[model samples]
Target: MSSPEQWTRPEPGAGPAATAAQPSPEQVIAGLRATAEGGAELTQLLTPEGERQPSRFDPYLADIDDAALRGLYRDMVLVRRADRECNAMQRQGQLGIWVPLLGQEAAQVGSGRALKPQDMAFPSYREHGVAYTRGVDFRELLGIFRCTDHSAWDFREHGFHPYTIVIGNQVLNATGYAMGQKFEGKVGNTDPDGKPSGTDEATIVYFGDGATSQGDVHEGFVWAAVYDAPVVFFCQNNQWAISEPTERQSRLPLYQRARGYGFPGIRVDGNDVLACLAVTRWALDECRHGNGPVLIEAFTYRMDAHTTTDDPTRYRLSDEIEVWKHKDPIERVRVHLARTGGADQEFFDQVQADADAFAAELRDYCFNMPDPPPERIFSEVYAEPSAALDAQREEYLAYLSGFADGGEQ
Candidate 1:
């Protein structure tokens, strides 16, 4: 059993010069001399250096041609650009707050792309990459954090749920949805031909390393396992749940927890987009075959603060941040694309230009989007109307009306 400390302990040699006074994230990571020593069943199709290896998942990539590969790259690039702009907006006081998914792009994008349009996804707040794959407009995402709307778009329209800010609770909701689909015979198709045979659906829920400790997450696991729900529990274990490390969260690797829940769990190199897509595809296939609910622990890292409000330097060492940068999800794919001739200078240039234009558009949208009307605060308090809320809304409105028209009325 690999301990939590083993899972998170900094790579060897923190470098002699590393000190509390002058911190260097780069030097701390470059000094490490460790290699891939041992692990439980972890799948890796793309190496950090952008090399491909033979794996059981090779067949899954048959349809992922060079053009498709370029598309995925484009997804990562644009999503990252949007995320960066949102973070900047928050810093500029345009947004209330922002959840930055700096290093977890591949894990979100790969799995999101694997999902069918009919399938549903439940997300924690930081799923910008998934939103991009779902064809969600960037402005819609801004509406949420800016407090202008409940959601950017209809959830069912994109099959992507509104972001759940309350941590792991969405796991149970996703499981219940999956179970309902199961009872309705909506499990994925088992046909030899890969077309949809029925309109039934599968569900996927995204949470983080911290949420695994929540009772709701565990209960969702239990119910899904017992009922054979066609759901994929995707946990991007990015090594920290706020300031607490995985070592403090569990005794062993998080994926191992699925074994106790009586289903198979697989760990994948979350930084490798190909591996993430392959593993998620395999799990979703199992769900369609009624052999579900599969748990996928995307072994990855969060290369930034948990949110814009967080000061990562206070909790984690600079060296620790540097170490994970080597395994960056976007860079690996870019390297592969360049080396394999999957994309050329023109393609790369176009992507950068597109990202810039997209970011500019997002900046304008966020700045121009109006604040929710005051009436919005009072609406939707209850199914009918609540006396207390109604009275409060009326009083607030009266106060506003008095100030209007130079206090004439």
Candidate 2:
């Protein structure tokens, strides 16, 4: 990991030794453009054209053989299919709203698959791919968009927290959880080589570029940094916070913000699943062995609108979208698998069939979902029964009963 001091230095030409301490107008304009290339600092194991590249982080991916690589490709395909189905369902009024993870499949799946069973994840609302990697049922997530339940799965069992809708709030929750893990001595056990040798755990919090501007995220950084909490701040820089471009959020790259908080930060090619997996594994290992609270900025794009209700076309150009389409995460992986003979046409066809079935199942579940009764909300509000709450529930139920047949009054 590079030291914080290294990140603070001005780029060779931008420092006081050059023209000025601040960037030139042209440099600022360049910064505002969507950086799909991720500049020179980007850690990439596979190019957008599906060519493999070597990196220092390659050792972290030793366990990912050709079979595992094919599995990763399948995961992305299924996730993208499910995402599209949910988006269409929302349009058809089957869901209240849907958050699309269309272009971020590699970022979520790679990082998510890096986590151990004991690790915890706190996610922002658009983490359907992460949820899938964590063994969460696709139908359970549908309940959230259907407005039928908060989250149907056991978060503790899954090592995944309920999807947080408010931006950056999950950072605080994840920091606190990591602090607890440290307090319980779940971190810092390692061998002489600094590799984990005991029962060590870590936490990862997922947020977006827009959330970087939030006070909660900054506070989480400060607290996690000061305590050396075992948390990885995973920011998927999808280039837009709704219609607002990432340039409007910060002049510097998002990953560089970690230097000020006293930890190492890295930028990875988010569209390259191989790079994401390697980099995330390295970060998590650092955290487990006590060198903690790393920041990872995944340089990716949002190929679709932010949410079902959002309109990306209003703020971004068609040309920009066209450019990112060439870097489609799933297509690159598919190309790599085919090129390497890791998978064949039969395998690709099978994966497509499976994804189609997955999407169809989700659509069936959403359409047939039973609406909860008004009194159902009161059932889960308290672990211990409360007289006041019971009275309120009783009165509410009675009020509903007074209607012609339930709700026709």
Candidate 3:
């Protein structure tokens, strides 16, 4: 069993003021309300101008050198570029559909990078950024959109579960995995220096604003709390789930709802990459130490339609989109880099060339990829193919191969 130090929170109904001068839960809640109303930014590290904030979160930012920060910026830009290409490919009838993460790159990348190799991630479809961070081939992501494969990569190899399309459905799966990590005795173990080791595996699950209304998400919360599972419920509150605005989802702010489930939750400026990184690091560390599950409502916006099938113009105003343009995560980082970190024309040119080359390679791979044999479809449908399934497979293969030229002219 984990020691008492594994968890850290005020005793039941005990407020922070009793031990420290810190604000109580009610005061924290009220402060958050005031902050939201004033449209103030919720962040712990990194300023809009690319400066680091002075706080505990600063330690996380300390090791990130200028080159590393540039790399982070590059990752966000490359992911967005891939997103754009995929969207265009779908429009051109190359893909069945594409989920664009135009405005949520920072939220995904920052949180995604915070994960350790031992950690597991369960993500909703929009977490293409997370997939990239886990070393899943960027072009492999297109396989699902192209209808060529059920999932592009093996989950176990990448520490990523298959992308879940049904909103909030993967939350329970994540909680279960975290519970498994506990049962495997991965928690409460430390190295020689009395520090936690890789044996402490945590899980981070991603969902959207609309998923909060789903029964699966609520059940996930309940299970994680009951088992003390090492999981973080990462909600990217992008303000819209299809045509529905966030206002229609719930009355109270999303983060505070965690209290009802007996967990800790916080809201961060999702557009601010540094803040997302800091908050996610905190959340993951807490989970690894057994102080979980944590709920993070990343306050962000969806800059594009829900998917290729929907059009935003039908329900939203152009001015609203324009307003979010200032909060553009990529542009903000670039501005900070250029103004403070001396990101000059040469750096910009090199990054752009690299991005372009990457996109070209992805296009080539996607277009030239060979389709799986028709018979292979039913191969994994069952542990062992039943007589009826075998007969059906034979029939289909025969019918498919019966075409005058072996199904090919």
Each model's lDDT comes to 0.83, 0.88, 0.81
The sequence of per-residue lDDT tens digits that candidate 3 reaches over residues 134-182 is: 9999878888888878776888888999889888899989999999988
Worst 10 residues of 3 by lDDT: 1-10
Candidate 1 to truth, TM: 0.87
User: Estimated TM-score per prediction?
Assistant: 0.87, 0.91, 0.87
Q: After superposition, how far is residue 128 of candidate 1 from its true place, in Å?
A: 1.0
Model 2 has an lDDT value of 0.88
Question: Which candidate gets the maximum lDDT versus the true structure?
Answer: 2
What lDDT score is found at residue 327 in candidate 2? Answer: 89
Estimate, for each residue in 42-85, the C-alpha lDDT of model 1 and write its tens digit. Answer: 78888889998889988888999999889988988988998999
